[model samples]
Target: MINRKILARVAGVGAAATVAMGLFSTGAANADTFVPLPGGEIVKTLSDGTVVTVRLVGESANINPSLGSTPVHRNAWVSGSAQVELSGTGADSGGRIFPGYTVGCQVNIAGGGTSGGVDGGVAWEDGSPSIGASGGGDLSLGPGQAQSFYILDLEQADDFGSETHKKRNVFSGSNGSVTWADSTIGLSGCGGYAQARAFVSVEVETESVVTWITLYGQPFSIG
Candidate 1:
């Protein structure tokens, strides 16, 4: 017969059984404990087969220079063609955002992109056929501030492009207070085409917020 005392020690319950027996005794076998490995980040795969990677690209204050007065604000954004490939058995909807994945984006402007009179009244707004030109007020950078935000719609097509190629206007996860600058900033026209061909738009989306800070003085306001 197997030694009961040796089994208890190997089983890791020898001490418990020893107290009951008044002498060293083997303990019953206990289930092995399982420990999970660390370091695997969970990523959501969307229905459109798009993978949403969450990360901080930049901050609003770092991107926008116009917010030097009240708060240092900036916008985080992502732009480029998207890549889609079929791995398993799944249907293609032409234009559909895969569920589980999220595309969050934000964008701010330089001093030149601000409102009228404040920054010489010159406004740098981008416009596209689908989403159109977005104004500074959308970001609520305040009177002298200006910024924009964006994200992939994944579902609807706002810009003019091949449905088979996945053409859609980017949307903002933020409220009406935040929005994209315009298609004109990067895209050529309302037409989402590159080199006059069906270009594949594979790009990543970004998101950000405004960080409040103090602004400096001007030549007139100081002296």
Candidate 2:
């Protein structure tokens, strides 16, 4: 389980910045930075009928820097959907970014089986490790099948108000076929309070079952 008391202290720029710092540290396996491609496009529309054009900046971790709109919230979580597009030889290179915090995600691969999972626990940088799994059994991947694992994102809008980095105690399982190809990972949220950022980088490493990983969406800090 996540320690809410510790999360309460992960606040402000120092605390929030930790979110980015921890993910991109050089110590981790295949450590790399999230960089955006040039001439990219991003369009975000809110439930209130508000739309904004996000300018392309440096892209990293599959998350686009151009999607710089205030996160909408759902039940106190950042809400809203931002259309993300990556076009170039590097599209399949790195992982993608979501925006603020990743509440949920799905993965699909064309012409291949799917196998992926998300666990909730303090990231390697946080010093503590916790497993965030929604299902009781280990997620499986069969040949030529596509599977998706959905986990409740630990980062919430209310979490922003708290001081410490917000790490939730819940996690989802990965379900899909097993194969090698350029796959897609996506994160979706609702409500004005929920915020998530996605990043894509080729440098990150994953389980052996994953032949190649593409970061469809990852989140980062803006404030």
Q: Please give me the total number of clashing residue pairs in predicted model 2.
A: 88
Q: After superposition, how far is residue 119 of candidate 1 from its true place, in Å?
A: 33
Off by over 4 Å in 2: 1-41, 45-49, 52-138, 153-223
What tens-digit string does per-residue lDDT give for candidate 1 at 120-175?
A: 12232221111222431122222322222223232333467544322232222211
Q: What are the models' TM-scores?
A: 0.21, 0.20
lDDT of each: 0.18, 0.22
Indicate the residue-level lDDT of 147 in model 2: 25
Clashes of each: 25, 88
Considering summed lDDT, which 10 consecutive residues are worst modelled in model 2?
9-18
RMSD of each: 27.6, 20.4
Minimum summed lDDT over a 10-residue window in model 1 is located at 12-21
lDDT of 2: 0.22
